[model samples]
Target: MIQPFIRVDGPAAALPEENVDTDIIYPARFLLITARLGLGPYAFHDRRFRADGTEVAEFVLNRPEWREAPILVAGANFGSGSSREQAVWALLGRGIRCVIAPSFGEIFQANCYRNGVLPITLPPAQVAALSAAAAAAHPFAVDLEAGTVTVAGRPPIPFSVDLERRLALLNGWDETATLLNAYGADIGTFEERHRRHQPWLFEGENDA
Candidate 1:
């Protein structure tokens, strides 16, 4: 099971560029990497590295302090263009558990939640404030229960998540887990009803 996301206590970073696509997040060439682990080095490969494979020090993530930041405050449409789950994996590889942005690609946002990442959609102004805070390398605390993000020396910023997704994150439940938890007994009852109506379907089983 994925770790429950009650809270995240760690440093944060900012990437203020708009419309960063999934391929940019995890370059298409590296898609051969089916494994979700060890994708940190490839996250924003072209943006963070040169043709010869040296680090691009100018990139915020390549900087020493922001390298391990677990929270990212990004610009509008942070993850757009494709339905690549690997993009979220790459972010996870960088220890990023939460991403704050004004908006995101629908598929990428859903992928984040399913993969144990929190994609917080805040107002543009709020996102900018968080970005500023991240630029200062302030540690952040995201309390899922409280629905707020707290940065050092600042008042808690409120955000909203879908109740279902929120519950899944808090309980560490994926889609299947959530469904089974919510309807396992109902499903059992329905199966019994179906078996009674069609005994032949359960001929080998103890339908009696």
Candidate 2:
């Protein structure tokens, strides 16, 4: 199971470009590795490094102060491409615990929650404001329980998440765990009822 996401307090990195797909986040060349460890160095591989392997000086993540930021303030439609769980793995590998954006690809957003990354969706104006604040090298605080993003000079910004997703993140439960916790008793009762009503369905199991 992943770590629960309760609160994060740290510097924020800004990726202002829109429609950043999974391929951009964790280029397809690195997909062969099943283990999540060591994926951080390859995140944004093409955009962050030149062919000679030198870091791109202007890339937001390459900047001195933002290099280790734990929160990402991003643009609309972030994580827009293929439904690769590795994209979320790469970010988590890099220590990014939360991502704030105006919108996100549906599958990518789901994957984020499953892996303990909090993806917060706010209004466009709010996202832009947070991006600007992060660009200024300000630290931000994300409270999953409070549903607020707080920067020093601005008022706390509120964002919305589905109740189930929020609980999953707060409690560190993945999709399967969440479902089992929600319906385990009901499922067991149904199985017992079905067995009584259809004894012939179980008759061949003992005979073998």
Candidate 3:
């Protein structure tokens, strides 16, 4: 199950590169990975490490101050490309709960919601400000309930998320769970109607 995402308070990192796709987030070679928990090392694998497996000291995340950062300030069109949920898994594996950007791949943003990660879309200037704040190695606050991001030396930056999505993040409910919680009665009504109209479909369902 996804963890409740009321707020996240911690250091943040910056990735100013635009158009960083799913393959860049979680390389294609590791597509064999099926589990969600251990993909952290694979997030930005190529950019974060050398071919010989040594850490790329210059990469934002590899630096001592930003390593293990939980919030990421990214460039435009982040997570563009194939609809790979694994990409989100990779960030989650690395302990990243939030990514702030100007724009994102639609499917990737949806995947982020389903997996309990918040993808905050802000104007380019605000994102740049956050990225600069991130570079200072200071902690940032991402409050889902308040719909704001708190960076040092500035007013809380406001954001907007759909109502259903906001509740899903706060309550840690996956898509199916959220839908059921919202429409369980309606679904039951339909099922009852179906059973009445097509008794043959339920003929053996009640048998022990």
TM-score of 1: 0.86
RMSD score of candidate 2 (Å)? 3.8
- Please give the lDDT score at residue 196 for candidate 1: 95
**Ranking 1 against 3 by TM-score, winner:** 3
The true-versus-predicted C-alpha distance at residue 179 of model 2, in Å, is 1.9
| Clashing pairs for predicted structure model 3, backbone only | none
Task: Estimate the Cα RMSD of every predicted model relative to the unseen true structure.
Answer: 4.6, 3.8, 3.8
Candidate 1: worst-modelled 10 consecutive residues by lDDT? 199-208
Runs in model 3 lying further than 4 Å from the true structure: 184-208
For all candidates in order, the CA lDDT equals: 0.90, 0.91, 0.91
lDDT (Cα, tens digit) per residue for candidate 3, span 114-206: 899999999999999889889888679999999999986668989999998998899998789667888999998998899899989988675
lDDT per residue for candidate 2 within 60-178, as digits (tens), equals: 99999988999999999999989998999889989999999999999999899889999999889988989999999988999999999999777888888899889888998778866
- TM-scores of the candidates in the order shown: 0.86, 0.87, 0.87
- lDDT (Cα, 0-100) at 121 in candidate 3: 98
Q: In model 1, where do residues sit more than 4 Å from their true spots?
A: 181-208
